[model samples]
Target: MPAAKSDSPGRVRRIARLIFRVCLFGGLAAIATLVVAVLVTMASLPSFADMMQKPNGQTVRVHASDGSLLLSLGPSYGDWLPYDRIPAEMRNAIVAVEDRRFYSHPGVDPIGVARMFYVAKRLHDEGRRLQGGSTITQQIARNIFLSSKYSYGRKIREAILALAMERKFSKAQILELYLNRVYFGGGAYGIDAASRKFFGHPGDKLNLAEAAIIAGLVKAPSHYSPSADAQAARDRASVVLDVMVDAGTLTPAQAKGVNLDSVTFAPEPKQNSVRYFTDWALSQLDTIVDEQAAPLDVWTTLDKRMQDAADASIRQNTPKDLQGALVSMENDGAVRAMVGGTDYVTSIYNRATQAQRQPGSAFKLFVYLSALEAGVKPGDPVVDEPITIDNWSPRNSSRRFLGPIDVRTAFAFSINTVAAKIGQQVGFDSVADMAHRFGITTQINTHPSMVLGTSDVRLIELTRAFAAISANGNAVTPYGILKVSTTDGTVIYQREAVQPRVLVAPFVAAEMTDLLQTAVNVGTARAAQIGRPVAGKTGTTSSNKDGWFLGFSSGLTTGVWMGRDDAKPIPGLQGGRNPAQAFSAFMRVALQTRPAEKFATDPTLPEWQLEPDDEAYFGNPDQGFGGDGAPAPEAQDEVTGEVPDVQPAPGDVPPPADTPAAPPRAETPAEPQLDQRWLDNVLRDQKRPPQSPPRGN
Candidate 1:
């Protein structure tokens, strides 16, 4: 009976052993099937993220304010330094923090996994979650192939894939890939941009302190951001410096030399002072560079010196509460400087290239150019007397007839009546065509009012038109960029705005320039006259709001505009006052360094004999004045010989015309009325009274 019982026990033990064996085999089979299923799923899935294309090792363009290039973009591993160019210290920092036993273990670290599991279990008991042990290869796999879903199943797959990746790549290869893929924030995807952002220097040029700060950012970019948290970032950098020292990546003294405080994590990016030019240049990026490589380098014809001068002049000379713009371009249409507005930070309305305002008397240049083409000579007389055409009787600024003035004098003084008559005789279409040929891209209406510069034209187009005069009638459109290169210095595109010549004749342009110079010398634009010879026109719209000064020298052409953005009239401010002042200030500095040169003249342009008859253009007015009765002569005090209020001349009544009436006759206001209501409103809103009236009263 004892033998049988013992046999039964043995049988029972054998059965239990068999059951255990079957269960273990089934578990193995299930695990193999699951592994195959995960592999199939991963294989079938699309890429986790689009791979960033690296042209010449990746890049982003950095352009100067005037569209000139400061430099090109390169990789974090020492720009163009290749994977092998990585410093041993950086390599060590990455390896030590990411994977201490990277060389000794396969892609999946079993010891690390065991330790992580113990930690995770402890944390779970405390109702917390912790990171799983992810090896460098595991992270690479996840970055390249898997979604960052942070799931248990994903973790398992990551471990398996990591092991698989280890079989395919060497430790060094994996390390390099990991270093390049890490995000360091502030638009810096890799160490290169980070190095630049933090140290104002390149990654390869980084000292031990800068390197430590950058290395520390990988742990928690925001937490160690130098700009946002300088102290924390410095502390973190100190820890990195100590680690690097212990790793012998840096000497003790070298680490000590690295002042963590000296490492600025967020260095101020170089600002583009020439905001208008930079904005215009960026607008041309699509045409200048390949759409696929727009983030590359762009080289332009922008002259920094000229840009600085233009900007300073615009800001310093523009009146308070007024918008201003200045643009400077080379004779060939390469924009050297541009001031879009007084302050680009406060407002980005690029008045130089975008804002379109009436050209005012500046438009008379086109009218005069047309009349010249129509056989009218510069010295030909044009009557500045009252003239009417279809009920539009334009008057001069002085509102008094200037009989038999020469065309040169008429244009220089911006005589409205003479310019209108010339427009009538030459035909508005002819003048419009001349403007078009001069690179006026904006539409121009063919109306008599167009003669007085009624068309809306941006400063960019105006400057380009003036460029024709500087180029001896050869028109060249202004552009921002000259060449674009890939991140690795591969020239992708080049631009030079030298198109086929579009002008009547170089000599015609030279002659026109000669007449314009007279305007600056002793005419309406006298304020713009520099010691050096300059040519330009002053313009004031009928509303006295928009004022303009378009001028140029042999090497450059510039346009200045002053006006309120709201188009509100500015009393006492005229083109010659503010616009010309700003233009003169800018040109003085801009042309200081430019060689004193002169535009070439061609004496063979369509020759026409000078006609000195002013009556031909002015003719006669059909009717007499239609306003209040003529005033009497000035009254004199017999006792003290004091002059009394003067009266208008007999039959000198104001004429009815489409042109805005001459501003109200100057008068001394009463003390109570002397305070401007508009100014009072401004001061009242600020809880301040208007400053005491100036002593001028």
Candidate 2:
């Protein structure tokens, strides 16, 4: 029995020694594997300089013409602040709230990591998110060299990189790098940028309360942003102050005395309409300048007051269910104000620049301009009788044809038949060319109905065409970017002041302006007259699906469009009613400070005297086409799916007498008489009877 007991003790000791040897080898293997992993990760990293560079490329800061900040595009990084430049309060607050043992730890805090895992496991048991355990130096390592991917391998690499950073950089250097690289809410990337964005100053000027508020954002930037919710930010700041007190950086009394209420935030703009302009301006940057690695300051032509005025006009005039867009530019094509929709936040679609809706009768400007360019005199007689071409007949909005009216009267009343006749005479291709020459970039359909604006057009381009007329025949290319420079004002791109291309002869433009003036003064666009010499055109599509008004006064040309996004009709909607009133309202405020200017009149062209027959046919200007003192409705152009209600003609009305006498004005020269026989022959051809359909077999 004694011999068996001794053998058992010896066997137990052998088993203990064998287990110890196995554990020792396993520990050694683990150490060797860790060393290999560290080496491989180190070799894969880029150089430190490359690592410290901003991850997202360059930022672009757009400014208005008056030097006011419109908005920042991309991540905005301010000038880097040295350790001395960073306020003590900001540094202490950041260290206290983010990592209390930052100064004492060797890059990675073991205690912090252990506490994080414990808390994370407890939170996981309760069905919550896992908590982060990133020290200040570890955070710097992850931000610079790695991404926020969760894995033990990533954590190990982060710790190793943090150790390497600590070995290379001083404590102050590490803190400075952290302060300069951290992201704050509102697109600010650094302490100085956050300070300037939130408090309108630099980081060196931050007080205790401001520092606490900014530091609190390091946890959840969007949630604790002061601009987003001031009270929540203040409460977060209080928590940061409490942490500072616990860390012994500030006394309890000192923390209590820091008045977060006294921290005043920078005032935000009242209107977000400017974002639409900024978005458009940003799109042009790549085309203007080469790909830039450094930040750019883009100065645009947006006028804040004019934008506000436009927003107010649209909100007040546009109906609740419908949407409206407006674009205004100088005679030289510097876009001043643009409102894409009623609210930019809900819809980012820039209707003024993006949407291509039918311009309706407002497009007649191009048709008439084409006619004038073809040597058709405004005073020449044209028949407004019913006409059909290619089995398609167009009717006037009034449904009553004024027989043998002068070209000016027909255009002023938006006579669809006369416009179609003029379009055919001038050639639809010629009208399309005229629109293109005036800056329309969209494709134009050349169907017979296209003369009445069947082809869809953008509001911005349409406004630019009118601006060309307002600028005395000079072609305008709409531009918003005035200059693009570096942060230190190094000029990268500046729009060179060049004389505009002359698209039309001054006399032709003058003639067109005369027709437009008649449109606003005595025709369908009478609602757009702002007690000044305003010239504009009104257009309404079939069933009132789209309403539009394009006008110009002083040195500005503005266009307004109102419609449903789905192209559905609005009840009782007409271009002359709402769109014209909106234009007038906006222009009144836009041109309030500027002097009223008269449209250029061609003295060479003679004014036609009213004949007795013509006078009876054309009623009072204010009473409109009905001659009952009721305002004329907008001209509705025919489109697909719309059928014209053609009423039976009363009888064939005879042509008016040829060659009316010319009235004399003090400023006008002696007028040359037009060839009446040529004019009559042209009118007769336009008034030809329609061909009858062949009998069915």
Candidate 3:
């Protein structure tokens, strides 16, 4: 029965022929349609010439604050360089590692693609991730234009786009764009940035070992970064070098010349000395000029060497608990150096210009200046005795009666009672006016306490104020930039000298200088003396909240302040200690090269007493003083630190017999014999009232 059912050979042959003919016709039609579809798609795309004509985005070069080149900051997209800049070894390494037959076909290599497909299939079978077979150009296309929304449709689109790109752009162009745009990790967007970020210089400057290491970084930047994994980076570099040798991109002899182990990297240079000054000048310029995009190159008066020395000095001298700021300028108002803080890294807030704090005894300079302007000689007998003005009976910082102290002693020791007396006599308004005229721009109260630095003042303002004394009493506005030049050497900005007279005659200025020198050599500011001729003043505010050391020499004038950011005091830390130490250390290094010169003093300058201003001593509005008529000490003649020879009875110095005695001890425990005038003004309001004795006693 099965033999009878068997089909004839002719029918089997006809069926087979029919099946073959139908399959062939269908395949031909499908092929024709696919070709037409591809042609239409190509026709719709931009012409090759038009695609090539697109402009790359702008490239902006970033420079250091001092105009030194740090890097070129290019846009994250679109910008590219020529492939000629790329090393041949790098190109070969990429081809050998990624697509072996990259140049053998058009944009999409069919055989390589097929081989990739087979590998991917194998990997999938083995439960592994799909390996890539993209040519460099194809990768560039995928990375630039396509989102990683994985799908068969996306893959087809990417292939078509890659083909379009290859047709439009040269291989060199495509490769350059790809290399520039590829992510190299560590926040580096391109090979150039990667070169800088990893090796601390430009890409073109790299050695062979560095080049190999960077070439290896393309595989997995973080994994091969020398900073992240030194051994891994070395291993990857070795492999990359081996690949170069195998591809014949590098000869064996040349490969031998390249030492992967010899590649060394340098630490990024920190240009901080000029940074603060540059920032200051920029800030000033921004405020002065309306246009921010003016592309200005400011020429500041910042002495780079001096600034570095000042910073170094502050670091060396300041205690762990202290932070310091220094500003120095010539009598002509050319700022030589400035230290904004001990570590600008720790706090960018500039203590020289940005911080506002009480001045303490340093404020007494204004009072004395005002007093001298008011025709009161330094020898004027302003009683040191505690006197009552309003309801306040102010005493010295020691809270005891000091007998027969002079004005010079009051200022040298920073006697609070005498400083108040002088401020009252000269009129607090006059002191405030002097402070303002001397370039102190902060708001100040016209109270007796203001004479003691109760008002807030920034270090810059005080620096300028002190500069007046340095300039023979001519107030000088501290300026930084001398001129700003464009890249092409066009002068875009220039600084102008503005000098305003704020004090009396140059004789008075000379007299003040002598007294200040005495202050340093034999008084409260003795700690500020250097081996060379130097002058400065030490000021400690109430509760040790703010420690101030302001001084100036011929070479540099710097002021340091030490305290907590908030008004709280650090334990066992004072301006005289840490701030003074920093100033001394900094000045020592700064003035090393400069010839030592004595401070200018005139013998023609009239001699003045160092007596405390009796009215100032008794008349502080913050503390009401009753006219109890305490016995006051007479103003003593100016003397060095040595004890006076003609010492009268302590009770009968010079003031009225009924005048009260001034404090016998110094305000600060560290200096028991110094005066305490300016400090009393700061603490008068905060000072505790005299305690009443027990009734039983």
Candidate 4:
């Protein structure tokens, strides 16, 4: 027994020695691995000078024609402020919230690290994850040199880089770099940009409360942005103030007197509608300039005054449940004002440029333009009786038609039967071709009812078509960007000043203008007249699903559209009732500073006169038409039909190689001759005023 006990003691001694050697070797291997990781991280580090000098990323700042800032496209930055220029309160607040021992610690704070470890152990035991414990310098290292991905190796690298940075730069220089590089939310980088974005002032002017608010944002930007939630931001600022008191940067009494309630943020823009314009302009940037790494300044053709006017008109005129869009442009297609919807915040879908809705009678401009181009005169007589083609019957809005009326009178009244008859007289293909020639890019379904504007179209494209008419038959391409340049005034792209392509003959445009003028003066669009030589057409789709007014005056063309997004009918809605009035209201303000100009008049053509019955229905030439009567409604504009194949079948389409072809059928006229009595009445009506004609409802 004594010998066994002696052996047991020796075995215990050997086991202890083995454990000690194994632990020592393991510790050395771990140390060696850590050292190698540090060395690798150092070698891969980005140049310190380059990191400090470079911006976060390329930004595109959009501005209005008058040089007012509209919005920024990418990461927004301001000029870097030096240490001396930064407010003392801002520096103090940042230090108190981010790192109390910012001045005393070498970049890796020992106390903070120990606390972080203890917290991490506790969290692990409770089934939670560890939170970050980076000091100001460590944050600078991570932001400038390393990715935000967290791992043991990343932390070791962060510490090593921070320590190196502290050794190279002074405390003031390090702080200045951190302030200028950190993201401050709201797409703003750096204190200067954040200050201007939230408070509308520079960083040098930050008060204690404002400084605290800005300082509190480093931890959670979107959650506590003042622009997002003022009360939450103020509560966070109060926490920052408390930290400042604890850090001895401010006395308790001084902190107590600071009123977060008195802190007022800058007013947000009246509406986010400008974002729609900016989004459109940004899309064209790639086509205009080559892909660039530096920031750019895009000067656009937005007129703030006209944009505000259009917004107000839509807001005040449109019903609450319905939506409205307005687009205004110069005669050359430079878009000056555009409101995509009633509120862009609720819906970013730009109705003015994106949504395609049927433009009712307003589309008749193309049909009439085609007829005039085919040698149909404005004073020519047309029958407005009920008609049917391909089992499809179309009637006038009034349900009763003026049997025999001149082309100008029928157009002014927006008579549906007359437009359809004209479409047949001039082939429907010609009408669709006319629309394309005038700048409408949407597909046109050319049915008999197409003359009444059945196919869908975007509001902006329709406005561009009208701009062509206003430009005296010249084609217009809608554009917003005027010039693009660098921040230092180096021009990257300037719009080339080229002559516009001619799309229509001047004589045809003149006759179309005459028809449009008659519509505004004594027909469906009477509400759109602005006490000047203005011309426009009113459009109302079936069940009042869509209403439109496309008009021009004072060298500007504006198109207004009102409808429900779901294509549901709005009770009692008509093109002349709300759409025309909105157009007039917007144009009145848009042209307040400009003089009214007259459309080109054809001196050789005979004077346009209304039929005897039409003169009585209009009541007075000075008061215009539809005084107390309801504005004309549109007939059912569309009907479902199978589209015929324009091309023949591929198989068995041609005769056999040896077969003889059949003879062609006898020719038939595409249109019947107009009644001579109607033409005789039209010529006689222009010579004298009517004596007594029946009044119309």
Candidates by lDDT, descending order:
4, 2, 1, 3
lDDT of 3 at 62: 28
Q: Model 4, 6: alpha-carbon shift in Å?
A: 12
Question: Cα RMSD for candidate 1?
Answer: 15.7
- Per-residue lDDT over 1-697 for candidate 3, one digit per residue giving the tens place of the 0 to 100 score: 7665565776788999999999999999977875565566556656544443332233333233254442333332323345787766556666665556666666778997788789988998999866466777667666656665666676676677677666656776666666666766665655666677778776555567777787787778778877678778888888877777787677778877877767775554454544555567556765554444334455557666667667666665555545667777776677777777767655777777788998877877788888776766554444567765566554454455455544555676666778778878878888888888888888989865676677889987887777778777776777776765554667656666674665657766666666566566445565455555556666666566776778877636677877767777554444445556556555655666676666666211112222244222212222222111121111111111222222222221122222222232121112233356733542452243322211110
Model 3 spans with C-alpha error above 4 angstroms:
1-82, 87-171, 174-190, 201-266, 271-273, 287-297, 388-394, 499-504, 531-533, 593-697
Cα lDDT of candidate 1 equals 0.65
What TM-score, to 2 decimals, does candidate 4 have?
0.75
**Worst lDDT 10-window in candidate 3:** 631-640
Q: Per-residue lDDT of 1-697 in model 1, one digit per residue for the tens?
A: 9899879988999999999999999999987986676566556543322323332234556575465555444433334333576666677776666677788897778799889989999999999887747877887778666777888988878877776656655676667666666666555656666776766666566665666677787778877877668788789878887777776566888877766665445555544456567667877676655556245777777787777677777766677788888888877777888888877767878888888898887887788888866767665545557888887777655544545546766666567788888999999999999998887889999978788888999888888887777777787778767777765777878764455675866556766776677566445565564445578887777657787889986577899998889998765456766677667666666666555554353111101211234222111111111112222111110111112122332222132222223232222111111125633542343343212111100
Q: Candidate 1 at 54: error in angstroms?
A: 5.5
Q: Model 4, 1-697: lDDT tens per residue?
A: 9999989988999999899889889889986875665566556655657666867668888999899998777787787898999999999999999989999998889999999999999999999988779999999988877788889898988898887777667789889989988988888888999999899998888999999999999999999998789899999999999999999999999999999999889876555678778777788899989947689999999999888778877876676688999999998888999888889888888999999999988899999999989988777767778899777788765555556666777787678888888999899999999999888899998889899889999999999988888888899888999999998999989998769798888867777887787777666676665556677888888777998999998689999999999999876566776777678667766776786566785211123333334323223223322222233232222222111121221221122122122233112111111246645655576456423221111
Better of 1 and 4 by lDDT: 4
The local distance difference test score of each candidate is: 0.65, 0.77, 0.61, 0.78
**Best candidate, lDDT-wise?**
4
Worst 10 residues of 4 by lDDT: 665-674
- What TM-score, to 2 decimals, does candidate 3 have? 0.59
